[model samples]
Target: MQITVNKTGGFAGVNQRLGPVETSSLDSGVADQVRRIVTESDFFHLPEDLQGAPVYDGFHYAVQVLDGTAEHTVILAGMSDDPVVARLHELIHLLDEAVGFQWI
Candidate 1:
Protein backbone atom coordinates (compact mmCIF):
# COMPACT_ATOMS: atom_id res chain seq x y z
CA MET A 1 0.00 0.00 0.00
CA GLN A 2 1.05 3.53 -0.69
CA ILE A 3 -0.18 6.86 0.62
CA THR A 4 0.55 10.33 -0.67
CA VAL A 5 -0.24 13.68 0.86
CA ASN A 6 -0.12 17.07 -0.83
CA LYS A 7 -0.72 20.17 1.24
CA THR A 8 -1.26 23.61 -0.22
CA GLY A 9 -2.72 27.11 0.29
CA GLY A 10 -1.67 27.75 3.85
CA PHE A 11 -1.04 31.18 5.35
CA ALA A 12 2.41 31.10 3.74
CA GLY A 13 0.99 29.69 0.50
CA VAL A 14 3.72 27.08 0.48
CA ASN A 15 3.01 23.79 -1.19
CA GLN A 16 4.42 20.55 0.22
CA ARG A 17 4.42 16.98 -0.98
CA LEU A 18 5.05 14.00 1.25
CA GLY A 19 5.43 10.53 0.00
CA PRO A 20 4.19 7.99 -2.22
CA VAL A 21 5.67 6.10 0.74
CA GLU A 22 5.06 2.43 0.89
CA THR A 23 3.55 1.13 4.11
CA SER A 24 6.11 -1.67 4.26
CA SER A 25 8.97 0.80 4.14
CA LEU A 26 7.83 2.62 7.28
CA ASP A 27 8.49 1.54 10.83
CA SER A 28 6.08 -1.10 12.04
CA GLY A 29 4.54 1.28 14.55
CA VAL A 30 4.16 4.05 12.00
CA ALA A 31 2.64 1.67 9.52
CA ASP A 32 0.16 0.53 12.11
CA GLN A 33 -0.66 4.11 12.94
CA VAL A 34 -1.31 4.87 9.31
CA ARG A 35 -3.55 1.85 8.93
CA ARG A 36 -5.51 2.75 12.04
CA ILE A 37 -5.98 6.31 10.89
CA VAL A 38 -7.13 5.22 7.46
CA THR A 39 -9.55 2.74 8.90
CA GLU A 40 -10.89 5.13 11.52
CA SER A 41 -11.28 7.92 9.01
CA ASP A 42 -13.07 5.61 6.59
CA PHE A 43 -10.96 7.20 3.93
CA PHE A 44 -11.87 4.79 1.18
CA HIS A 45 -15.55 5.40 1.76
CA LEU A 46 -15.28 9.15 1.43
CA PRO A 47 -16.11 11.09 -1.70
CA GLU A 48 -13.34 12.01 -4.08
CA ASP A 49 -13.98 15.68 -3.59
CA LEU A 50 -14.41 17.15 -0.11
CA GLN A 51 -13.91 20.87 -0.54
CA GLY A 52 -16.52 22.45 1.67
CA ALA A 53 -17.30 26.02 0.60
CA PRO A 54 -13.73 27.13 1.27
CA VAL A 55 -12.19 29.49 3.79
CA TYR A 56 -9.89 32.46 3.39
CA ASP A 57 -6.26 31.62 4.14
CA GLY A 58 -7.20 28.04 4.93
CA PHE A 59 -5.12 25.16 3.71
CA HIS A 60 -6.10 22.59 1.12
CA TYR A 61 -5.19 18.91 1.36
CA ALA A 62 -5.15 16.13 -1.18
CA VAL A 63 -4.68 12.57 -0.01
CA GLN A 64 -4.39 9.49 -2.16
CA VAL A 65 -4.33 5.91 -0.98
CA LEU A 66 -3.51 2.92 -3.10
CA ASP A 67 -4.16 -0.56 -1.92
CA GLY A 68 -3.62 -3.21 -4.56
CA THR A 69 -6.21 -2.59 -7.31
CA ALA A 70 -8.22 -0.08 -5.28
CA GLU A 71 -7.34 3.58 -5.19
CA HIS A 72 -9.09 6.42 -3.38
CA THR A 73 -8.49 10.13 -3.49
CA VAL A 74 -9.91 12.87 -1.32
CA ILE A 75 -9.50 16.60 -1.55
CA LEU A 76 -10.42 18.68 1.47
CA ALA A 77 -10.49 22.23 2.68
CA GLY A 78 -8.53 23.00 5.83
CA MET A 79 -11.31 24.41 7.97
CA SER A 80 -14.04 21.92 7.24
CA ASP A 81 -16.08 20.86 10.29
CA ASP A 82 -16.63 17.29 9.16
CA PRO A 83 -15.31 14.58 11.43
CA VAL A 84 -13.66 12.81 8.53
CA VAL A 85 -11.89 15.99 7.58
CA ALA A 86 -10.71 16.47 11.14
CA ARG A 87 -9.34 12.95 11.21
CA LEU A 88 -7.64 13.44 7.91
CA HIS A 89 -5.99 16.58 9.20
CA GLU A 90 -4.72 14.73 12.20
CA LEU A 91 -3.43 11.90 10.05
CA ILE A 92 -1.65 14.31 7.78
CA HIS A 93 -0.06 16.03 10.72
CA LEU A 94 1.17 12.70 12.01
CA LEU A 95 2.57 11.82 8.62
CA ASP A 96 4.29 15.18 8.37
CA GLU A 97 5.94 14.63 11.68
CA ALA A 98 7.08 11.18 10.69
CA VAL A 99 8.56 12.47 7.46
CA GLY A 100 10.28 15.43 9.09
CA PHE A 101 8.28 18.17 7.40
CA GLN A 102 6.36 20.75 9.40
CA TRP A 103 4.20 22.03 6.55
CA ILE A 104 1.00 21.23 8.39
Candidate 2:
Protein backbone atom coordinates (compact mmCIF):
# COMPACT_ATOMS: atom_id res chain seq x y z
CA MET A 1 0.00 0.00 0.00
CA GLN A 2 1.41 3.38 -0.98
CA ILE A 3 0.57 6.12 1.52
CA THR A 4 1.13 9.37 -0.30
CA VAL A 5 1.67 12.38 1.92
CA ASN A 6 0.86 15.62 0.18
CA LYS A 7 1.79 18.77 2.06
CA THR A 8 -0.44 21.76 1.54
CA GLY A 9 0.14 25.43 2.36
CA GLY A 10 2.13 26.11 5.51
CA PHE A 11 3.60 28.97 7.60
CA ALA A 12 0.24 30.68 7.24
CA GLY A 13 -2.56 28.10 7.20
CA VAL A 14 -2.99 25.16 9.55
CA ASN A 15 -0.72 23.14 7.25
CA GLN A 16 -3.63 20.91 6.41
CA ARG A 17 -2.97 18.28 3.77
CA LEU A 18 -5.59 15.66 2.98
CA GLY A 19 -3.17 13.19 1.46
CA PRO A 20 -4.32 10.34 -0.75
CA VAL A 21 -3.80 6.77 0.41
CA GLU A 22 -3.67 3.88 -2.07
CA THR A 23 -4.21 0.46 -0.52
CA SER A 24 -3.09 -2.08 -3.09
CA SER A 25 -0.74 -4.44 -1.26
CA LEU A 26 -2.84 -5.88 1.54
CA ASP A 27 -1.77 -8.63 3.88
CA SER A 28 -4.06 -11.54 4.55
CA GLY A 29 -5.04 -10.37 8.01
CA VAL A 30 -6.08 -6.84 7.02
CA ALA A 31 -7.71 -8.05 3.86
CA ASP A 32 -9.79 -10.60 5.69
CA GLN A 33 -10.89 -8.14 8.34
CA VAL A 34 -11.90 -5.54 5.80
CA ARG A 35 -13.87 -8.10 3.85
CA ARG A 36 -15.72 -9.22 6.94
CA ILE A 37 -16.50 -5.70 8.01
CA VAL A 38 -17.76 -4.75 4.60
CA THR A 39 -20.02 -7.75 4.47
CA GLU A 40 -21.37 -7.23 7.99
CA SER A 41 -21.71 -3.48 7.95
CA ASP A 42 -25.22 -2.10 7.41
CA PHE A 43 -25.17 -0.91 3.84
CA PHE A 44 -28.69 0.44 4.28
CA HIS A 45 -27.69 2.12 7.53
CA LEU A 46 -27.12 5.82 7.71
CA PRO A 47 -23.79 7.47 8.33
CA GLU A 48 -22.13 6.24 11.48
CA ASP A 49 -23.07 8.37 14.40
CA LEU A 50 -19.92 9.76 15.96
CA GLN A 51 -20.65 11.66 19.14
CA GLY A 52 -17.70 12.39 21.37
CA ALA A 53 -14.81 14.73 21.82
CA PRO A 54 -13.80 15.87 18.39
CA VAL A 55 -10.56 14.36 17.09
CA TYR A 56 -9.60 17.77 15.80
CA ASP A 57 -10.90 20.94 17.38
CA GLY A 58 -11.88 22.66 14.15
CA PHE A 59 -11.66 19.87 11.62
CA HIS A 60 -14.54 17.53 10.91
CA TYR A 61 -14.60 14.02 9.40
CA ALA A 62 -16.28 13.07 6.14
CA VAL A 63 -16.23 9.36 5.29
CA GLN A 64 -17.80 7.78 2.24
CA VAL A 65 -18.08 4.31 0.81
CA LEU A 66 -17.60 4.54 -2.94
CA ASP A 67 -20.86 3.68 -4.74
CA GLY A 68 -20.78 0.21 -6.29
CA THR A 69 -17.34 0.02 -4.76
CA ALA A 70 -15.93 -1.89 -1.80
CA GLU A 71 -13.72 0.97 -0.68
CA HIS A 72 -14.96 2.32 2.64
CA THR A 73 -13.83 5.61 4.10
CA VAL A 74 -13.81 6.71 7.72
CA ILE A 75 -12.80 10.34 7.55
CA LEU A 76 -11.75 11.74 10.86
CA ALA A 77 -9.38 14.39 12.06
CA GLY A 78 -5.86 14.01 10.63
CA MET A 79 -4.86 11.66 13.44
CA SER A 80 -6.25 10.47 16.72
CA ASP A 81 -4.88 11.04 20.18
CA ASP A 82 -4.46 7.32 20.61
CA PRO A 83 -1.77 5.71 18.51
CA VAL A 84 -3.88 2.62 17.99
CA VAL A 85 -6.73 4.69 16.58
CA ALA A 86 -4.37 6.51 14.27
CA ARG A 87 -2.85 3.28 13.04
CA LEU A 88 -6.24 1.72 12.44
CA HIS A 89 -7.36 4.76 10.44
CA GLU A 90 -4.31 4.52 8.18
CA LEU A 91 -4.78 0.82 7.82
CA ILE A 92 -8.36 1.33 6.64
CA HIS A 93 -7.19 3.83 4.06
CA LEU A 94 -4.75 1.22 2.81
CA LEU A 95 -7.66 -1.18 2.42
CA ASP A 96 -9.39 1.46 0.32
CA GLU A 97 -6.49 1.41 -2.12
CA ALA A 98 -6.17 -2.33 -2.23
CA VAL A 99 -9.65 -3.82 -2.74
CA GLY A 100 -11.84 -1.02 -3.96
CA PHE A 101 -15.62 -1.12 -3.71
CA GLN A 102 -15.82 -2.73 -7.12
CA TRP A 103 -14.89 -6.17 -5.84
CA ILE A 104 -17.47 -5.96 -3.11
Candidate 3:
Protein backbone atom coordinates (compact mmCIF):
# COMPACT_ATOMS: atom_id res chain seq x y z
CA MET A 1 0.00 0.00 0.00
CA GLN A 2 1.10 3.52 -0.82
CA ILE A 3 -0.32 6.92 -0.03
CA THR A 4 0.60 10.36 -1.29
CA VAL A 5 -0.47 13.73 0.06
CA ASN A 6 -0.14 17.07 -1.66
CA LYS A 7 -0.86 20.37 0.08
CA THR A 8 -1.32 23.49 -2.00
CA GLY A 9 -3.00 26.91 -2.22
CA GLY A 10 -1.83 28.17 1.09
CA PHE A 11 -0.93 31.64 2.35
CA ALA A 12 2.61 31.42 1.03
CA GLY A 13 1.49 30.01 -2.30
CA VAL A 14 3.93 27.16 -1.88
CA ASN A 15 3.00 23.60 -2.84
CA GLN A 16 4.24 20.47 -1.09
CA ARG A 17 4.09 16.73 -1.70
CA LEU A 18 4.26 14.12 0.97
CA GLY A 19 4.62 10.55 -0.24
CA PRO A 20 3.89 7.68 -2.13
CA VAL A 21 4.54 6.62 1.45
CA GLU A 22 5.12 2.91 1.34
CA THR A 23 3.22 1.14 4.06
CA SER A 24 5.79 -1.64 4.02
CA SER A 25 8.43 0.79 5.18
CA LEU A 26 6.39 2.35 7.96
CA ASP A 27 5.85 1.19 11.51
CA SER A 28 3.21 -1.47 11.85
CA GLY A 29 0.99 0.73 13.95
CA VAL A 30 1.05 3.56 11.46
CA ALA A 31 0.63 1.25 8.50
CA ASP A 32 -2.31 -0.44 10.16
CA GLN A 33 -3.85 2.91 10.87
CA VAL A 34 -3.57 3.80 7.22
CA ARG A 35 -5.33 0.62 6.21
CA ARG A 36 -8.05 1.13 8.78
CA ILE A 37 -8.55 4.74 7.86
CA VAL A 38 -8.82 3.94 4.18
CA THR A 39 -11.30 1.15 4.74
CA GLU A 40 -13.48 2.81 7.36
CA SER A 41 -13.45 6.14 5.52
CA ASP A 42 -14.33 4.49 2.21
CA PHE A 43 -11.42 6.32 0.67
CA PHE A 44 -11.64 4.59 -2.68
CA HIS A 45 -15.27 5.38 -3.39
CA LEU A 46 -15.19 9.02 -2.35
CA PRO A 47 -15.68 11.70 -4.98
CA GLU A 48 -12.39 12.92 -6.36
CA ASP A 49 -13.11 16.52 -5.48
CA LEU A 50 -14.46 17.57 -2.09
CA GLN A 51 -14.81 21.33 -2.21
CA GLY A 52 -15.13 23.14 1.07
CA ALA A 53 -15.68 26.58 2.58
CA PRO A 54 -13.09 28.07 0.21
CA VAL A 55 -11.19 30.47 2.38
CA TYR A 56 -8.90 32.50 0.18
CA ASP A 57 -5.69 31.64 2.04
CA GLY A 58 -6.61 28.19 3.25
CA PHE A 59 -4.71 25.11 2.17
CA HIS A 60 -5.99 22.46 -0.24
CA TYR A 61 -5.23 18.81 0.24
CA ALA A 62 -4.93 16.06 -2.32
CA VAL A 63 -4.63 12.54 -0.99
CA GLN A 64 -3.97 9.57 -3.23
CA VAL A 65 -4.15 5.99 -2.05
CA LEU A 66 -2.94 3.00 -3.99
CA ASP A 67 -3.35 -0.36 -2.39
CA GLY A 68 -3.43 -3.78 -4.00
CA THR A 69 -7.13 -3.74 -4.80
CA ALA A 70 -7.73 -0.13 -5.76
CA GLU A 71 -6.43 3.40 -6.27
CA HIS A 72 -8.15 6.72 -5.67
CA THR A 73 -7.58 10.37 -4.88
CA VAL A 74 -9.52 12.92 -2.86
CA ILE A 75 -8.96 16.65 -3.03
CA LEU A 76 -10.47 18.93 -0.43
CA ALA A 77 -10.32 22.39 1.00
CA GLY A 78 -8.73 22.74 4.43
CA MET A 79 -11.71 24.42 5.94
CA SER A 80 -14.88 22.35 6.07
CA ASP A 81 -17.58 21.00 8.36
CA ASP A 82 -17.94 17.55 6.86
CA PRO A 83 -17.13 14.49 8.95
CA VAL A 84 -15.43 12.55 6.20
CA VAL A 85 -13.32 15.50 5.31
CA ALA A 86 -12.40 15.82 8.95
CA ARG A 87 -11.31 12.21 9.01
CA LEU A 88 -9.16 12.68 5.94
CA HIS A 89 -7.67 15.73 7.52
CA GLU A 90 -6.74 13.74 10.58
CA LEU A 91 -5.24 11.06 8.40
CA ILE A 92 -3.04 13.65 6.77
CA HIS A 93 -1.87 14.83 10.16
CA LEU A 94 -1.12 11.28 11.15
CA LEU A 95 0.95 10.77 8.04
CA ASP A 96 2.74 14.00 8.75
CA GLU A 97 3.72 12.83 12.19
CA ALA A 98 4.53 9.23 11.39
CA VAL A 99 6.02 9.20 7.91
CA GLY A 100 6.20 12.76 6.76
CA PHE A 101 8.12 13.78 3.71
CA GLN A 102 7.02 17.41 3.59
CA TRP A 103 5.86 20.27 5.72
CA ILE A 104 2.13 20.72 6.49
Candidate 4:
Protein backbone atom coordinates (compact mmCIF):
# COMPACT_ATOMS: atom_id res chain seq x y z
CA MET A 1 0.00 0.00 0.00
CA GLN A 2 1.26 3.45 -0.91
CA ILE A 3 0.00 6.24 1.36
CA THR A 4 0.93 9.88 1.24
CA VAL A 5 -0.15 12.91 3.28
CA ASN A 6 0.64 16.58 2.88
CA LYS A 7 0.05 19.19 5.57
CA THR A 8 -0.92 22.63 4.45
CA GLY A 9 -3.25 25.54 5.29
CA GLY A 10 -3.85 24.75 8.94
CA PHE A 11 -2.66 25.54 12.45
CA ALA A 12 0.94 24.60 13.20
CA GLY A 13 -0.07 21.39 15.02
CA VAL A 14 -2.60 20.03 12.53
CA ASN A 15 -1.64 16.87 10.54
CA GLN A 16 -2.82 15.36 7.26
CA ARG A 17 -1.91 12.28 5.19
CA LEU A 18 -3.11 10.05 2.32
CA GLY A 19 -2.30 6.60 0.92
CA PRO A 20 -3.08 4.04 -1.76
CA VAL A 21 -3.93 0.59 -0.33
CA GLU A 22 -3.59 -2.15 -2.88
CA THR A 23 -6.37 -4.63 -2.26
CA SER A 24 -4.49 -7.25 -4.23
CA SER A 25 -1.62 -6.93 -1.80
CA LEU A 26 -3.55 -7.33 1.43
CA ASP A 27 -4.59 -10.69 2.84
CA SER A 28 -8.25 -11.49 2.39
CA GLY A 29 -9.04 -11.17 6.09
CA VAL A 30 -6.95 -8.08 6.53
CA ALA A 31 -8.43 -6.54 3.43
CA ASP A 32 -11.88 -7.32 4.70
CA GLN A 33 -11.08 -5.61 7.97
CA VAL A 34 -9.84 -2.54 6.15
CA ARG A 35 -12.94 -2.54 4.03
CA ARG A 36 -15.13 -2.65 7.11
CA ILE A 37 -13.28 0.23 8.69
CA VAL A 38 -13.64 2.47 5.64
CA THR A 39 -16.85 3.28 3.82
CA GLU A 40 -19.18 5.98 2.53
CA SER A 41 -19.44 8.23 5.56
CA ASP A 42 -21.19 11.54 6.11
CA PHE A 43 -19.22 14.75 6.11
CA PHE A 44 -22.25 16.73 7.32
CA HIS A 45 -21.00 16.25 10.86
CA LEU A 46 -17.68 17.79 10.00
CA PRO A 47 -17.14 21.51 10.49
CA GLU A 48 -17.58 22.09 6.78
CA ASP A 49 -19.74 21.38 3.77
CA LEU A 50 -18.97 19.05 0.85
CA GLN A 51 -18.95 21.89 -1.63
CA GLY A 52 -17.64 24.56 0.69
CA ALA A 53 -16.43 24.24 4.27
CA PRO A 54 -13.56 25.55 6.27
CA VAL A 55 -11.06 22.80 7.02
CA TYR A 56 -8.08 24.57 8.47
CA ASP A 57 -6.68 28.05 8.77
CA GLY A 58 -8.82 29.47 5.96
CA PHE A 59 -8.85 26.25 3.95
CA HIS A 60 -11.26 23.51 2.82
CA TYR A 61 -10.91 19.80 2.07
CA ALA A 62 -11.83 18.36 -1.27
CA VAL A 63 -11.88 14.57 -1.43
CA GLN A 64 -11.77 12.50 -4.58
CA VAL A 65 -12.27 8.73 -4.50
CA LEU A 66 -11.37 6.24 -7.20
CA ASP A 67 -10.57 2.57 -7.58
CA GLY A 68 -7.28 1.85 -5.82
CA THR A 69 -6.66 5.55 -5.38
CA ALA A 70 -7.82 8.54 -3.33
CA GLU A 71 -6.84 12.17 -3.53
CA HIS A 72 -7.42 15.13 -1.21
CA THR A 73 -6.80 18.84 -1.41
CA VAL A 74 -6.91 21.20 1.56
CA ILE A 75 -8.50 24.50 0.67
CA LEU A 76 -7.50 27.65 2.49
CA ALA A 77 -9.85 29.37 4.96
CA GLY A 78 -10.31 25.97 6.64
CA MET A 79 -9.87 24.84 10.21
CA SER A 80 -10.04 21.39 11.71
CA ASP A 81 -10.13 20.74 15.45
CA ASP A 82 -10.33 16.99 14.95
CA PRO A 83 -7.36 15.23 13.38
CA VAL A 84 -9.27 12.14 12.27
CA VAL A 85 -10.96 14.11 9.50
CA ALA A 86 -7.86 13.74 7.34
CA ARG A 87 -7.42 10.09 8.20
CA LEU A 88 -11.08 9.47 7.44
CA HIS A 89 -10.61 10.99 4.02
CA GLU A 90 -7.84 8.54 3.29
CA LEU A 91 -9.86 5.68 4.71
CA ILE A 92 -12.78 6.57 2.49
CA HIS A 93 -10.48 6.10 -0.47
CA LEU A 94 -9.49 2.68 0.73
CA LEU A 95 -13.11 1.77 1.26
CA ASP A 96 -13.86 2.71 -2.30
CA GLU A 97 -11.12 0.39 -3.41
CA ALA A 98 -12.40 -2.36 -1.18
CA VAL A 99 -16.12 -2.30 -1.89
CA GLY A 100 -17.25 0.90 -3.54
CA PHE A 101 -19.94 1.10 -6.17
CA GLN A 102 -18.92 0.95 -9.82
CA TRP A 103 -20.61 1.25 -13.18
CA ILE A 104 -19.82 -1.39 -15.73
Better of 2 and 3 by TM-score: 3
lDDT of 2 by residue, 1-104 (tens): 23322222223333333323333346777656544444455322534433235433444333444433444444344434654334445545655455432210
Give lDDT tens digits, candidate 3, residues 5-93.
99888679858889879888888998888788888999999999998877898888889999888889999884678888988988898
| Residue 5 shift from truth in candidate 4, angstroms | 6.1
Q: In candidate 1, what are the lDDT values of residues 31-83, reduced to their tens digit? A: 89888989988888999988987688887778999998989999988456788
lDDT at residue 40 of model 2 (Cα atoms): 54
Q: Give the distance in Å from residue 92's predicted Cα in candidate 2 to where it truly belongs.
A: 3.9
Judged by lDDT relative to the true structure, which candidate is superior, 2 or 4? 4
- Models sorted by lDDT, best on top: 3, 1, 4, 2
For model 2, the superposed segments whose C-alpha errors exceed 4 Å read 1-24, 48-59, 67-104
Model 1 regions lying over 4 Å from their true place: 101-104
Locate the minimum summed-lDDT window of 10 residues in model 3. 95-104
In candidate 2 the C-alpha lDDT for residue 4 amounts to 25
User: For this target, which candidate reaches the highest TM-score against the unseen true structure?
Assistant: 3
Instruction: State which candidate, 2 or 4, has the greater TM-score.
Output: 2
State the weakest 10-residue window (summed lDDT) of model 4.
43-52
Report the Cα lDDT for candidate 2.
0.41
